[model samples]
Target: MATASLSAFTRGIGRYALVAALAAVFATFAALAPGFLSGANLVSVLVNNFALLAIVAVAMTFAVSAGGIDLSVGTAIDFASFAFVSLVLAGQPIPLAALGGLAGGALVGLFNAVLIAGIGISPFLATLGTLFVGRSVQQLLTNGGNPVYLPPAGVPEAFRFLGHGSVAGLPVPLLVAALVIAGAWLVLSRTRFGRVVLATGIQASVVRYSGIRLSRVTAATYVLVSAIAAIVGLILTSTVTVYIPSSGNAFLLNAIGATFIGTTFDPHGRPNVPGTVLGVLLLGIVANGLLLSGLNFYWQQVGTGLLIFSVLAIGFANRKAAARA
Candidate 1:
């Protein structure tokens, strides 16, 4: 009885390990780093660091919950950024450019859908191929990978608003992130289609036997994932006023890490919206705190990596203990 009780205690601790680490990190940074808890800095962390990644990580959660990984999310981001900047530079209206951006991302998703759902290719290989092809296409379009910059005089106010403007006293990007997170949570946790998607992920054969069109669901999922990722591209381009080739790939690894780390939040190890958002917050805080603490880029990465490992390890150890008990 004592052993069983001890195991239960250990498992409980492991389940909340990520949350504990996040609080500990935040408090530590607040104590050690000057101005770390300042309102402006907190806002900066949310707006600049957390918001974009949160969107991408949530998008990633959909793919993960659907029993696949989208290595091409960055590809979607780059395509959207390219389209948005290209249209703006060509004297198009901001609305039109935004549509073009979304269309570009949708195209990438459509391609992945065709490959995975239509051709029966594995999601991993299909997206990996898409990523490679995307890189090559960007290079070719940019004449060996030069950036497309929007002229300062031609920059539109509405476009700038997306990245820098505020609505209801909140940054626009953060507002958008909140909306995405909320919408995703609702779809996944409350909707019939969401339940079907999760069922497909867990047991594709069972879902298929239930008369659901697995291919259609899968195609729609990949498209949705890419469309969500494109939001990040729009915000990123607006922030920088330029579309740098392959720049969106920078978020790919971190987004993946965040999504997986989020799974630890679920007893069954499922991907979830709240968990992913928290994961993104944890990462965002760590990055900002490390920078404020005078850590260089390399060291910041190391710290982030170590933090992820520690959290995942704790979760894994607890899960094993629970199984044994």
Candidate 2:
């Protein structure tokens, strides 16, 4: 009886620990970092720092929750950026350019789906191979990975609006991130497809036995994940007006880290949209605050790593104690 009660208590801690950590981190920065809570600085964090990572992390949540990891998510982002910039520079309409970008990302997902679902390759190996091939393609296209920049005079106003313009005093990127989060939450928690995704992750054989097409689910999962990633590519290209090959790799580790950090919030250790958002916010705060505090880039990484480790370690210790009780 005591063991069961302890186990329940530990589970509760595991679920809420990430939330507590986020609050505590926010408070610490607000107190110690000058102007940390200023409205403009906060907005910068949300739009400039948090937006891209949030989108990619949300993309990763679907993949992870479906029992797969997409190392090629950055590949999607890079290809989309390349396509968007190429078309925009070629004088294509903004809408068409955006579609081209999305299509580029979808192509990466299709390739992965083909390998993983059609040919029965492991997700890790399949996506990793995709990442390598993507790098080679980008290098070949740009004279060894040279960036493609859109002429400032040639960029359309509508294209700029997606990255820099405001609607109702909110950054466009933030609004987009919010919409993605909401959509992801709805799909994960409120739809039949969501249940299938969750069940597929937990037990693929059971999902198959229930008459669900596991291959289709896996394919859809990767496609949607890559499509969402491509949107980030478009936003990034708009913001910078340039497409830097392999630049999306910057968000790769953090997306994976944020997604896993989020899993700590689920008592069952499942990946979730809300938890992933919170995790992204926490990392964003840490990054912004550390920069304000004049920490070197390497030290900022160390700080982030320590915070992630500490949070997971504490939760793990609690669970271990409960098990022993």
Candidate 3:
């Protein structure tokens, strides 16, 4: 078999290999910790990750599906959260401040789109630049300090409801995550824009040659990603009631790792919403399980990084095998 053919087969199989690896990891953790899958802990994991991981996973799906990546998403969300909470604490109405913050995210997306698609810069490099810019902006705004606390006065219980309240005994975060997943799935599965993204990701020039405007699709994707990130920021700050400039740091690595697993089952090389959601759940479970197992917080980070690397390696192997066949 030719080298290129063999590589492609490997990539194809690497996808499923990731699935098995994810399952195996869960099994090992369960065996090592008796209460790893208890009803309470299970719910805990879902509730914690539902906002951050699930939101970014769904957005990463859109970004990656469009044949692009946004390294800045994590920090960008932080900026949005800080800007938003600061406004609320300063007595600004929630709607006005939130809309402005969400718009700010869209602007960040627009910046990324311009750099990557319009200027023909590499998406990785472009987003890396924005990642720093976004983080720096948050730091600059906060001036090397934590943001002021946002008291819940005048904030609608229903608005905070998305983060804290539950429906049918299930946390609102889960419901929101589900809704985001369903929305993403619908866009990818049922829309012309979705088809455009797939085409662009595989070969933008080819689609462009067919007279389609690929840049628009690509640019729009960054906007969508940033918007989603802001939405997550909103829920997160509400849940915590304070804005930490570095709050979204964990999402940077966790999101990429989970995002990859999501793509295996989806059309756009994205974290299939369900796969990404499950991946988020798995990450939450891993951390919670380790903590419950008496592992140090430091060990949790180490184990998580290693787990992500291992899963990526398995995904690589699967993709390679499938390519060769």
lDDT of 2 by residue, 1-325 (tens): 1123555545658656777888888898888889999999999899877989999999999999999899999999999999999998888999999999999998999999999889989889999999999999999999999999888987889999889988998889999999999899899888999889889889899999999999999999999989999999999999999999999888888999898888777666678887788889989999999887777889998999999898778667655665676
Which of 1 and 3 is ahead in lDDT?
1
What digit string (tens of lDDT, one per residue) describes model 1 on residues 248-314? 9999999999998887766656788877888899999999999999978799989999999999898
Off by over 4 Å in 1: 1-12
- Local error of candidate 1 at residue 298 (angstroms): 2.7
Model 2: per-residue Cα lDDT at residue 291: 84
lDDT of 1 at 121: 94
What does the lDDT come to for candidate 3? Answer: 0.73
Q: Model 1 clash pairs?
A: none
Worst lDDT 10-window in candidate 2: 1-10
Cα deviation of 245 in candidate 1 (Å)? Answer: 0.9
lDDT of each: 0.90, 0.88, 0.73
Per-residue lDDT over 5-106 for candidate 3, one digit per residue giving the tens place of the 0 to 100 score: 544434454545555766876788788877877988777767774456888877887777777788888766776777777677676777777776677667
